[model samples]
Target chain A: MVKVHFTSHLRHVAPSDPVEAAGATVADVLTDVFARHPAVRGYVLDDQDRIRLHIAVFVDGTHVRKDILAAPVTPASEVYVLQALSGG
Target chain B: MAERLYVSTRKGLLVYARDAKTWKHHATHFLGAPVSIVLPSADNQTVFCALNLGHFGAKLHRSTDGGVTWTELEPPKYPKVETSDAAEKEKAPAVAQLWSMAWAGPDKPGALWAGTTPGLFYSKDLGATWELNEGLWNMPERARWFGGGTIDPALHAICVDPRNSNRVAVAVSCGGVTVTEDGGKTWRVAGKGLRAEFMPPDQQFDPVIQDVHMLAQSPSHPQMWWVQHHNGIFVCTDDLQSWDEITTAPISHFGFPVAVHPKDGNTAWFVPAKKDEHRYPVDGNMVVNRTRDGGKTFETLRRGLPQGQCFDLVYRHGLAVDETGDHLAMGSTTGGLWTSPNGGDDWMLLTAHLAPIYAVRFA
Candidate 1:
């Protein structure tokens, strides 16, 4: 099981604590997280089911490449989803 | 005159109400969000705001009980493009902004029309769900639409005929004007006689590529419409079939917004600014040009406006006229707001420090 966490901004949309979900890849982990907290899907992913351009998703402290939902994740890894620090 | 005014700004949505003859700030919503446009429902009971969130994407909010509270609605979304070409699939479009919206005429209280960048959307249940107007989206000429001042070409002005709800016309920034008679099922491009100086001489009058800044239709005369084009001012009397350029303004004709009188199609107002590269008020003086004889002559009104080194720029949706046509309100890119009680003859600076105003509408 991997632990998934969100930034404060995402928490405002769907309040949550760090959650543990089982997945071999980041895509599966997000799918697992979205199944439980449906409202966060639109904020994290766009209409094309890809990570939003300004949203940063990190797995086990390593920055995931854009649209790279297939990156492998360990059972004990921690994934963090945060908004990019841009815009005024 | 409208008792309430709504101003959509770069930072938030500000509401103002008239008390006895003076306007005062009433409320503010989405304090830190970029509100691109605000429109009240046909009854003026429900107000809708479109926000361009920097990170989360475009969002829509509704307030039925005035501005006290708001409920987020499902914003319109572009369908996922199905293509095998990686280049085409990677460049799939999204709703970059909600440029304009209108109530789906008087009879269809449950329906609303939304104009967004790249396409138009129709909502049947007060914005709970939206369906893209496929007819306008699939038009082959859309490939020639390019961004005017925005990253993507935007469908900014929507005019629904007051007499018939099914007949609607929408103005795209660089896609000219498209009209539909059978609701959203079918559409035709109809911007004729509009000249584009930016294009080559041979393609200057192409209807599909004319850049229309804003479009306004006289409420009493449904067939009379006014357009603030990138080149200059144009008026259409034979519905949307053709337009006639008006070049009699005393001041520079380059501007964004055009407000026509509700009761008289012959009266209209526009804020003139320097052309193309320089967008500030001409000669560092802010002025409004009013035409009462169907654009044959113009009166430069600046009695209450700044005559010194003012650099205010009114956007395409910044100037609005109330139902009575006697009251007018305009907001500027320099965070200035002004109101005129007797047309454009005189103006009063309501507030000079709000935010960069994107649109202003009376409620």
Candidate 2:
């Protein structure tokens, strides 16, 4: 099981509390999470299914960049979805 | 239960309730972010708030319980050009903020129209999904347009004809105005008779390049349109084919929000301020000018308003009148709220502190 947690900025869009979803990889966990709360899909990802520019996703405390959801995940992996503390 | 007012400002959203004799500040939402625009559905059960996060981009939040709680939804974003070229990003227009919003009416429940910087967007599924109206965005005149006070040219005023859902008119600051008869499919620039003093004398009346600050067409009178352009005020009496400038104001012709009487198309109210020089109230005195005979003459209403040392300004959506024109509310950039319960005859200060107000909508 993978634990998926959302940042405070996105909590209003969906439950921020970490949720458990069965998955062997980050991609599968994200698919499971998006399946449960579809409204967060657009905010976390763009129209091309790529992570939004300001959004950062990490698996087991390690940030994932290009292969957003391809990172391998163990049962104890913790996924964090956060908006980068940024300005431009 | 009294009528409620929704005020959006640079700081947040403020809600107020008014009874027979007094106004009460009720609640505040989005405590920190700049809430540039907000609209309450006719039924008052649902409200949509547009927040402009400086670096995070634009966001839209909906409140089902009269603004007590909000659910952030996917806001309108600049469309990704279908082109696979890497340069597509540089050419795409940037969406600065969701400056304005309106309901498509009960005929199409959950349908919404959003007016944003650089273009317009429409949502059929209650803001969950949005599609940019590329027809208006692709016009050749876009390259020549620019913003006045705002950072970028925007579709500030979206007047949807209640009589015909397909007929809609939008006003863009520095980009003039456009009317779409096919429900956002195709658009025609409709700035006839309006003049822009800032433009070169040769192109002042071209209609497409005029600096239109605001546009208002009362729901009761769909054919009668009023445009508060940057240079002067105009009224369209011939189905938008042409307009007549209302040059009878006692003060400057430049202003922001123009509130038309809900029932009487000939009657309207406007806030007069100095033009590009200062952008504050004319003569450093705040006053509301109302026209009852189609702008033939404007009676100045400033009974309880600040008489001297008042320089607050009103935005395009900052002055609003409820279903009954008698209940008028206006907010200022200096965080002042004023209400006229007797149809603009007399006014009273509601509050003097909040934030730089962006919009005032009475429900």
Give the top-scoring candidate (lDDT): 1
Q: Write the per-residue lDDT of candidate 1 for residues B19-107, one digit (tens) a residue.
A: 88768998888998899999885455789999998788888998887767788887899888888787886799888789999999878
Off by over 4 Å in 1: B82-85
The per-residue C-alpha lDDT of model 2 at residue A19 equals 82
TM-score of each candidate structure, all chains considered together: 0.96, 0.83
lDDT, candidate 1, at A7: 88
lDDT of each: 0.89, 0.83
Residues B1-363 of candidate 2: C-alpha lDDT, one tens digit per residue: 227899998889988887668778888999977998998876677889998875456788998988777888878877665775646643555566888898876688899899988678999998888988888888777777787777788788888888887888888888887888988888888877888888788988887778887899976777888888787889887778888888898788889889998899888999989987689998789999899888888999998888878889988898988788888999999999998887788888999887889999988
Model 2: how far residue B108 lies from native, Å: 1.7
DockQ of each: 0.69, 0.14
Indicate the DockQ of the complex predicted as candidate 1.
0.69
In model 2, what are the clashing residue pairs, if there are any? none
Reference-based lDDT, residue A80, model 1: 91
Candidate with the greatest DockQ versus the true structure: 1
